[model samples]
Target: MIEILNPAKLAQARVTGALVADILQALKSRATVGTNLLDIDRWTQTMIADAGAESCYVDYAPSFGSGPFGHYVCTAVNDAVLHGLPYDYALADGDLLTLDLAVSQGGVAADSAISFVVGESPAPESLALIDATQRALRAGIAAAGPGARTGDLSYAIGSVLSEAGYPINTEFGGHGIGSTMHQDPHISNTGRPGRGYKLRPGLLLALEPWVMEDTDELVTDADGWTLRSATGCRTAHSEHTIAITEDGAEILTLPTQDR
Candidate 1:
């Protein structure tokens, strides 16, 4: 469903969004070479509890996923990209890591993701992939605002990634996010401009643009939720929850200092 948050709810949404952003920033800072994915998940649990927020993922059961995601955050490394269920794996130098998170506070939900290299052993190709996703995400957000169409955001995002010489994967992309984690108005990475759902004030969208290094294809891991690159090449994903406003689109998921 497409939910339009009232001013009261928007107030709460801003709070929730800040929490989501802060948590992600904290996790990114705490993560490093040799850090266990499970440790990250545990840290997330503590932070969420300390904030009195509820996790949108722990018990989330979507058709695309195998079952209830029994984790507080998604820890994707290297070849793994989306829905990366945290497991017993230690991050290594040069490993590209992606952390996706969503949480609900005061009945409002916000979602976001970030990708970064674990240590100094940064791979040039991995760095490029991460940069592309970040740029694509920025482009998508720039295209979002009142009176804009979902297609515009998609087109803007796709142009950046495609121009970067990376293949676009639409199997999983952005979506409406509000009271619930995922909602209506599916936003693909690439599409015809001037098409799809029209943007309006009070609408919230999680605009994510993810891509694989070598191919657009994806292969599920044995864990049932981690989506990895079909060619086992490194991948990256960037996302943020934004609110459509009368003046323009406001990025709700930016860090408190960034907002």
Candidate 2:
């Protein structure tokens, strides 16, 4: 369902978005060589509970997944991209890690993701992949505003990934997010401009641009939730929850900073 949040709801969204951002950043800082994936999940759980927020993931059973996710965060590493379920695995130096999170505060939900290298000696390719996804995410956000088409955002995102020589997989992409985690008007990583749903003020969209190094194909892990590149090539994903406004897009998921 497509829900346009009212000002009060939007206010709640901003709070939730900031919480998501803060949690992701904290997880990244704690992610180091030898850190267990389960540790990350636990950290997420603590933060969400402490903030008096609800997790959008745990107990989430979707058709594509095996069953209820039973986790608080998505910890994708190296070849893994989307829906990387936390497992009994330890991180390694130079491993490319992606953390995706969504939470609800005051009944409003916001989502965001980040890709970064864990530990020192990050491979050059890994660094490049992370950079590309970050740039694509910015481009997508820049293209969003009142009256803008969803296609415009997708096109802007795809332009960056394509130029970076990475292939985008459209099986899963961004979507509308509000009281619920995933909502209507799917936003692909690539598309034609001036097409698809028109943006409206107070609309919240999670625009994520993810790319695999070599191919656009992906395969599900035995966990039934983690999606990995078909070629086992490194991957990266970047995302942000944005609000369409009269002035432009406001990145609600940006971590709060002291002035």
| Model 1 pairs whose backbones collide | none
Looking at model 2, residue 145 earns an lDDT score of 94
Please list the residue runs of candidate 2 whose C-alpha ends up more than 4 Å from where it truly belongs after superposition.
none
Deviating ranges (above 4 Å) for candidate 1: none
How much is the lDDT of residue 218 in candidate 2?
Answer: 96
Scored by CA lDDT, what does every candidate get? 0.94, 0.94
Residue 53: error of model 2 in Å?
A: 0.3
lDDT of 2 by residue, 80-122 (tens): 9999999999998999999999998899999999999988888
TM-score of candidate 2 on Cα atoms, chains taken together: 0.98
TM per candidate: 0.99, 0.98
lDDT of 1 by residue, 1-259 (tens): 8999999999999999999999999999989889999999999999999999999999998888898999999999999999999999999998899999999999999999999999889989988998999999999999999999999999999999999999988899999999999999999999989999999999999999999988999999887899999999999999999999998889899899897
Assess candidate 1 and give its lDDT: 0.94
Q: Which ten residues in a row have the lowest lDDT in candidate 1?
A: 60-69
